[model samples]
Target chain A: MKRVIFGSSWLPYAFLAPQILIVIIFFYLPAAEAVRASFYLENPFGGGSTFVGIDNYKDVLTDDNYVRVAKFTFWFSLLVTFFSLAIALLLAVKADTVLRGAKSYRILLMWVYAIAPPVAGLIGVLMFDQHVGPITDVAALFGYKMQIGVNYNDTAAAMIIISIWKQVPVNFIFFLSGLQSIPKAVREAAQIDCRSSWRRFWTVTFPMLAPTGFFLLIINITYALFDTFAVIDVVMKNEPGSNPMTLVYKVYLDGFRGSDLGGSSAQSVILMALVLLLTIFQFRMIERRVHYT
Target chain B: MMETTSSNLEVEARAGGRRTPLLSQRRFWRSVGDHTVLWLGVLFMLAPVLLAFLTSTHDAVTIHRDGLQFLPGDHFGETYEAVLFGATGFTGKATGLVMTFNSMVLGIGFAVGKIVISMMAAYAIVYFRIPFATLAFWVIFTTLLLPLEVRILPSYEIVQKMGLLNSYTGLILPLIASATGTFFFRQFFKSVPDELLEAARIDGAGPFKFFVDILVPMSKTMIAAIFIIMFVFGWNQYLWPTLITTDEGYYTLVRGIKQIIQVWVGANIPEYGQAMALAILAMLPPILVVVVFQRWFIKGLTESDK
Candidate 1:
């Protein structure tokens, strides 16, 4: 895009070679390998592989446990995305409104963003530990026993909670930045025209935030799909037996632990397709967005 | 982050002065309600980590009996000392100090490698003319669609084929293949004024000189911001490190979180105290970086992704 450009064919390629070589070796090679491996029935014990067209995909899609895991993944993504976004939006709105201790609130609400997912899960595990968990003790007070990593729903609930907790800071940052970027003229106009603050927020503030919200929706869904792998892995205590897991975790379990390379590759290809669809959908939304400026 | 808006201050001042008692009371209650919501949110974020820190101070037996401690205990010094300096882990070689070193290597190496390579790549694409430039750009940026997680198996096999397992290069190289940094730098380089390049050309400055003299200096803040974000990302990485590093010596602090719980399992009361201490050590550096360089961190995070 530079008007005054350097015209050196070898120099450009020389500079690009490292990034391109890395991409080919790591990204492209593995991705192509995944797609190719998906079509084969490969033995894990160092043997020949049979080119079994779509059977691996068929096996994955038709298994009952796979179906169950898929259902849980869907619900997990939805619940994590919805709760994290909602809590972040509420916090951002309140933080933006309050003049007292606002900076303190902003810092406190978002510092947890630096904690890794597994670390968050570790804290969650301690919080929901069977013996030493304060949250478990609180649950006992309420007559609801919490058995994380043992009871299916209890483990799922804990994972979701920790995932949401880890994710809130990210969403909060984006929403707060979005709220701050809203023009003062529009805000004052809304203040004069609308008597009810709630109504004003819905009509003026919320509409202005639709772009950020849309951007974050895709981000949150992608997050729930992949980045929560650490939390799920840690909370399931490294053995995901009948515990709920996102699709990403299942791929790891089947591929690495289970050593079903062909089957895992099939799942990988499926996830790649899913991600591509989501990204394309996101781009479409961005293209169609009504730019305020 | 929370700038004091003059308009908001003026509105609050008006609400407090000469307003009807009824209106002022309602305004005060609304402010109180706002503060309450924020407090709950802060508490929700803080309590788990606070409990983790507090529980880290107690000895294993006490923690096992008392649940998570609400307050610090006397065993804090011993716990932290043992984790940091004492020979621990299944191999007795993966002390917290060693893991922390590995984590720092990964973080700093990843950020520096990414920024350097991405700058080169972006500089080539933006400032040079090449026949296969479009193809290179497309191939590089397409990495954004499929994350490393999706192709973990194949990637592992590839790394295995290359025998990169247990090496620092293996840990860092494959992860940096993505074009996140390139994409960011490309956008930034495009925004840079064309006149600078023209002037440099007029001054007979070659591409390398122009890049070194003008662009790199201009990109100082950008590099710093990206460094912080990438440092946190590399330090926080769990899945990749979990797979590639079979050696105990290569365990990163984030990757070691699962290990603490897994190894100590059924060892009587388990070393809950040390585990929490390790977790604290894992989180502290990145948290400090983000909180300290908050503005640059936010910019790197919020801008780079887009």
Candidate 2:
């Protein structure tokens, strides 16, 4: 009995054993392999890989299409973050203070957000498929001949809209929590001081909501850059000018579609560098501004 | 005391019948602006689902004639029938029992596996004073930074090597553990009081009993939170499943929906009304879950704010 009790020091390891094993097998091991594959021109389906050094990285940088995609991705992330946060903040303030049936309204919002992005992507495709888009109808009402379809022609704008719509609920939830976290006394005190509503929000409420905003920015950008391609693939299929098409899709096309794993591995490496640089900046730069209190 | 009375008077002034200065009138106007903005935001957020609902009720002929509007057009049943039975002139079997079961198997299996592993790891980290505990915790947590898409290549290779592709386990395995769940559970277990465990130990309770009896009960809310999250994540998964399973028999609902919609789009033009009806149906289960467990979901988000 004593031996069993003492021997139980390994219980944490035992409890943790399954999770550690899975993470190693699934995430870490794969991530390490991805990095290694980035360096080599790999053809696993065919046989093995050849060492290509930094050629993949070089191709990703020097290529005009890669440069254009990188540019589009940056702008798309920035614009989506801006619009989604702005609209969400507006809703949060209204919901916190004056909206009736806020609970029901929020659930409605959450439901939309929780719908899988792929399904939402399909909805976007249905709504915007050139001949069928309701938004195109609206555009026509304004005497514009613009199409709302999910082709390569408008994928950049389509991606931005898709990202914004999908993320609005998440941003709204964040802002709602931020609004609730503020003490009512602070608003009352501002009222007593004869502060205007705009002044009060700019000075007090906005500052309090900063951390939530910061967190949303990081989460939103990462999701926009990484998780969006699958939705794009589903909706757009093999659109010609889809922005920031990762090495994943590029690899998918090269190996499966083109049967050239070498080029795909190189593309994947380039994609890794682009993502790593952004992630490091987020951790190193923006995280410092997050006010924990 | 003065502040309290003054605030009470303010409430009274606002509530009770009285006329105030133009300053108050301006404030009222500002609030009107706020309300307009808020209502518009709500309208925008709810617009897609509302559009889906409206479009689904109308036939292709109405949408073709009058455009997408919320007004009913008396073809809701017909559109659903067509979508379910491929009457809108699309190919392949209409999505029914087989697809839903496949989705359920994938979602429940992955969610259960993720939560169990997360809870055990969380319990171990908090209770046992293990070597490299902090390092393990941080390393696992940091993996959340890399999106699943970033690691798709390696994951595919691993799945291929294990010969799990096209199997239910293959559909679920790559997603069975989540770094976010560990982070949530670790935070939760850290809050469990040491005294409770001390009491259990003095009574000659073993670690397993102590965990089962004391710790699990204490962290029910956190577990519920993780469970809902993992369940939703697994249920909604698309790309990884699409990548691993090329077989239609193994397709989850989302993958199946994509396949059906792609075929619909590839034809001359999409059957907008029927497609919208299909999208609405796909959204129903998760929406029901949201309505049923909203309180837990909101509480989980707020609690984790700490």
Candidate 3:
């Protein structure tokens, strides 16, 4: 968009070659192959595949297990996005109120953003380990037995909790900044009109935070969909039948483990559509409302 | 001024006389509530790490027998030594050190490669008037949605066909063409003042000279910010390396930690101590980067969102 320019056509192309090459080779080619393969029944081995138009998609759409996995992924993404946003909003509001030690609190809450999903998963597994988990000891104090590995609900709960924990720091960073960006004068004006803190927050602060909330909603869903693949992989490695098998994980499982290339390609294409829709929605709707100031 | 001061003093005295106990109590409770919530958040964040570190210190027998120990044990030195230099006693191929090295290579390679390519792409798009430039930009931008998870099978096949399966290039290159980085750099470059470019042109500096001198220097903070993000991302890659690399020498720390936990001896128990140590090792570099570059990290996130 700049008016000032440099270089001829060939020079620009030369500059673009490396990125274009990689994108085509790694991204476009594979994406094209996935789309193409979705329509064909391919052998798991390197043998040639037969074009079975819409059959792979039909099988995936009708498969009961795929339905279950899709349902689980929907609920998982919802719960993670909701709880992480709510918890982060609470923490950010509280941290914003503190007149002292706010920096230390922010630092403490923020460093966890650096921990990878797999590491967070390992931490969750260790904390919830039935035999050696300290959380089980705490649960014993409450007179409840903690058996995460054996119970599907418990395993699903662990995955959700870890996903929320890993995601809260990111949401917190955004929400805290959002809260700070709401001018003090606006809050004070509201305070003069309405003395109740809760009412003031609802009428003034929450509406002001809508943009950030919407943005984080999209980001958290994207994260829950894709980024939690490692977390689920680690937590459910021993319990593959657990309820936390998201669509992304299912793609990997069906393609790599089940060796169902055509089926997995269908799943992949479906996931791509879902992500593309979410991304387009985010850029179109949510981005327009984001208040930069 | 005297009238205003006296009025202010009168108001302060009247309020102080009546509101002291009620206001002090409310303020005390509010402070207490804030600190309590903040500390609870801190505990939620740090407890897992503390427990991981604590469990790493103890011997596996004690852990297996007594469950997770809250207290630190005496095996810290020995456990870390064994994890770093010693073998897992099952398949003694990739040690903790070698895996760490591979992880470092992958992380640095991935970050540097992404930065270089994206910078050039952004520079060309922002500074040059090439044909189909907008189309090219959109093509790169659309990649934001096409993560590896969506195209895993074919991507793996493509890398395999390229004979880069076990090499660092295979591990890093495919993941390096990032839409986020290019998008970020394009925005950053667009913000660079036009006068700077004009001045450089007037100075008879060539495009390469202007880029290496003025642009790269100006982009140092942005580079640092992206470096922190991309390094952590690259270091934590799990599925890609797992799919591509079959050799032990190419194993990264993140993948290696999972392997340590999964690798089981026939009769012996899993190496919980070593696994914990490796987990801690894997966490160190990224945590260090975040802590060291905390300012730039936050800045990058905020700016990129804008």
Candidate 4:
């Protein structure tokens, strides 16, 4: 005990202080404040808050808008993850096989990925907005009169499309690397055995990509849930829509606009809990199926 | 035995099929397919950007006249001048100067502070074995679990309380102590061999000496990669900066450019040529960074996979 104590006595604490300080100041304290505020009914403008345990959470959970937002968050995450991963895998496999200009293609993809999400959203607004947007003009070439920016539903669709556009490149990079790391001989032998391209991919390529896919699935879902909501918020600010805002947006609306700090905090806490549970579940269940080698 | 052998040969020949064409038909077709798909994907990705570029180069009056043309024209010089120097007779304050300054301060402060502080912290954590280090680390990393947006309101309050509102400190401070950077540097430091440290110690090198001589020298590539990524992330930050910075002088490039688009679209549609030029300019630095670090970025991504 003495030796262990001596070995550990000062170093860890001293070394860890800076990091701990940051977390306390930036993360933990804020989180605690949020949780505390969630139980208190207060006006955001000024004055002290009164404690009202569970009421905020109850109010938010029972609200129809909240339920709608939760459903939207779920559906958005599910579809984005599914389509992004699918298209990414397809591109990766094709890129790996074709091998011509692959490097430049990958780099270009990352360039797009590096561009800001809000910028992308803004660009979407420019391109698709009804009055005199280029996208509207382009659509007119095909005799389709689609008003994108003005309509909340159309805006959401544009958001999703842009999300996919920006994301495919990064996801493709991950999947391609995963595919490339698998030995070429396994593929050659499979091919020599008269296995069709589709069959070989399903049997060989897809299995190898499981680990990358799993990581991306977790990260992308989290991103779509939390990060993209802000972009959507900016895009849809004060727009009329039953366009089904996500839980994150609802939190933003409730907190910043509604000035119901408690309700917003409750919603945020629930969001955090949902993410944690899902992440833990993923690690426990999906990690086993991920073929690391 | 001879019949069986002949049959096997015939089957193999059949599987091989007809002779490849002069250019090797299979290879040619495969190449065609590859090029087509690649070009298609590239076109899809580049189309909007190209359109925006075109629109920006064309004066607003002509844009409505031409209606979504991609060809470059004389308006490039005109629009470029307007975007940089401001429209000769437009209402609303010019945002170019404010945006550029804000972006520069935020990017430099965030990137430099993050790298320096993270390096120091990472060094201490890996080398010193401080008390409650694991717990401390867990606490630090727990911040990563919450997206910045999650606790943004409280953070806003905190910044307001600190009187950091409309200041560069507000933009820079929140970004400085990233868990991502700390974790990255820790992983890099942990990979350094102990024998090097012992040898350095024998040579009378202290912790600072050892770090400056050994660790930083060996970790240059990682540093470059981290700097590029962090700079890009900082430069691209929008919501927080937008929320905190109410002053026209504190608008970042993104906010400024976005405002231009909004104001142009809302009021005078003719100023879009200038808006497009500014947008293109705003995009250049991040693009250049990516281009410069392309090789290191790929290697960094691949290496971290392990």
Output the number of the TM-score-best candidate. 1
For model 2, the DockQ equals 0.44
Per-residue lDDT tens digits for candidate 1, residues A234-265, read: 89887788898888888999888888888899
Ordered list by DockQ, greatest first: 1, 3, 2, 4
Runs of candidate 3 with Cα error greater than 4 angstroms are: A7-9, A141-143, A290-293, B1-19, B89-91, B264-268
Most accurate candidate by lDDT: 1
Q: Which stretch of 10 consecutive residues in model 3 chain A shows the poorest summed lDDT?
A: A236-245
Q: How accurate is candidate 4 locally (lDDT)?
A: 0.70
DockQ of each: 0.74, 0.44, 0.60, 0.39
Docking class of 4: acceptable
The DockQ-derived docking category for candidate 1 is medium
Q: Write the per-residue lDDT of candidate 2 for residues A53-165, one digit (tens) a residue.
A: 88777876787866666666677667877888887888888778753456755775666656888778877765665566787777779986654333444655666677678
Better of 1 and 3 by TM-score: 1
Cα lDDT of model 4 by residue, A1-293, tens digit = 11111123444455556666766776776778888888999966687888988999899889988887787778778877788777777767767875345676676556775667666666666677676677677688999786664665666677677677767767877888888888889778878975577787788778777877777888788878876754575455345356557777777777777777888889888887877776686777575864456
For candidate 4, write residues B1-306 as lDDT tens digits.
Answer: 235434544444444456644435555555556556766677777787787788877778786666655787678887776666663232255545556667877877787777776777777667764556667667666666677777777877877888989888887777554487887888887777777777777788766677788889999999888877777778888778867887766778766644654454446455656656666767777878877788776665555431
Q: Which consecutive 10 residues in model 3 chain B have the weakest lDDT in total?
A: B1-10
Using DockQ as the measure, name the better of candidate 1 and candidate 3. 1
Clashing pairs in 4: A11-B129, A11-B130, A11-B131, A12-B129, A12-B130, A12-B131, A13-B130, A13-B131
| TM-scores, all models, native as reference | 0.97, 0.89, 0.94, 0.89
